[model samples]
Target: MTIKFRFHPEKAVEAAAILLKLHGKPMKYIGLLKMLYIADRLALKTMDQPITGDRYVSMDYGPVLRGVYDLIKGQPVDSALPLWSKYISPRDSNYVDLLQYPGNEELCEEEEMILKQVYETFGHLDPFLVEELCEEEEMILKQVYETFGHLDPFLVAEWTHDLPEWKDPHGSAIPILVEDVLRSMGKTEEEIEDISQEAQREAYLDGALPKIFG
Candidate 1:
């Protein structure tokens, strides 16, 4: 019922609010879409769902987000489909178009500045690649990290002892399944990790796991 979407850095939250209020907000913002996915996979694993890391992937955000928004607006969450139960399966895209302009160019300079600052505050931005990530989905997981890091009073009080790596949104290790996604692509492990970390956030967020989308 309490759906914590993305890592809420003070600035990212403010900038995103501006982005949504600009004209109209999408059913879900892009970054939230990404985090929603990582959260889904983590939920599946924690519940001991009958699925392997290779199977339980994130759900499609566009339709899911729209559906949930309408459902939450009308009926209770329990009435809606168990999104996790259905979409929980293995996952692994062409996304060059999204990478042309990295980050949220939709934001104004002032807004952009704030979002970037928030990204840095997180220790790093979306560093994992869409294709090369392990089952961990580190990029999306970053949101959960940021949200708790920002909003959780416990985390705030224990900042020095709690390093970023010590946290995971789904309460498990990240599944950065590099070899599986790029196995056919023939990328080496090192190359894949580099790509996943350096890949632009926009394309990575918008793109789906290759196995599903392809």
Candidate 2:
């Protein structure tokens, strides 16, 4: 059975604040998004689940966390608008500021470690450079897709394989599923259940599960 992922807005707010703190200054919205994406990818690789559990999509620029991207843009869903407005800056500005610190109650130690690692690795880099890297990855996926067509074996490799929890939609705009991401990581059903349950519990404790899962 496929497991559907749910977004945790409280966690997203906390993650954004953590990135801002690591950045040590206001951050370009795009750059912040890139860092969050990298951290989520790292989490999926090591923990079998993403931090925010936001749906991902392969865009021309790179893979994006759909809900988090919207939140960054100040256009979050109705349920997320209050928390997003209280914490995140307007997206029209060149950079975003943390209005208040969202505590780390939503994050586990491992997730915090991955966020720190991602920031240390890529936070100082230019946002455009990060976007270019993502474009390059997309190019590779596109080439492989064209060469192999859409057969399951070839598509699986080209779309996921050793890649970071991303799937090429083969020219279509289908959103990648969390189930596919965990599968790409070779997580067993038990592992998936454990990760998902933990994430849900965290969100519930943070009061985000009701808003997202309702």
- Over 34-102, each residue of candidate 1 has an lDDT whose tens digit, in order, gives 323223333223321101122212222221133322222333334332332122111111110111111
lDDT score at residue 29, model 2, on the 0-100 scale:
71
lDDT value, candidate 2, whole model:
0.58
Give the local distance difference test score of model 1: 0.28
Highest TM-score among the candidates is held by which one?
Answer: 2
Instruction: Give, for candidate 2, the lowest lDDT window spanning 10 residues.
Output: 128-137
Indicate the worst ten consecutive residues by lDDT in candidate 1: 90-99
Candidate 2, residues 89-157, lDDT tens digits: the string is 777576787776655656666666666555554555443001112222222222222322222222222
lDDT of each: 0.28, 0.58
Q: Which candidate leads in lDDT?
A: 2
Clashing pairs in 2: none
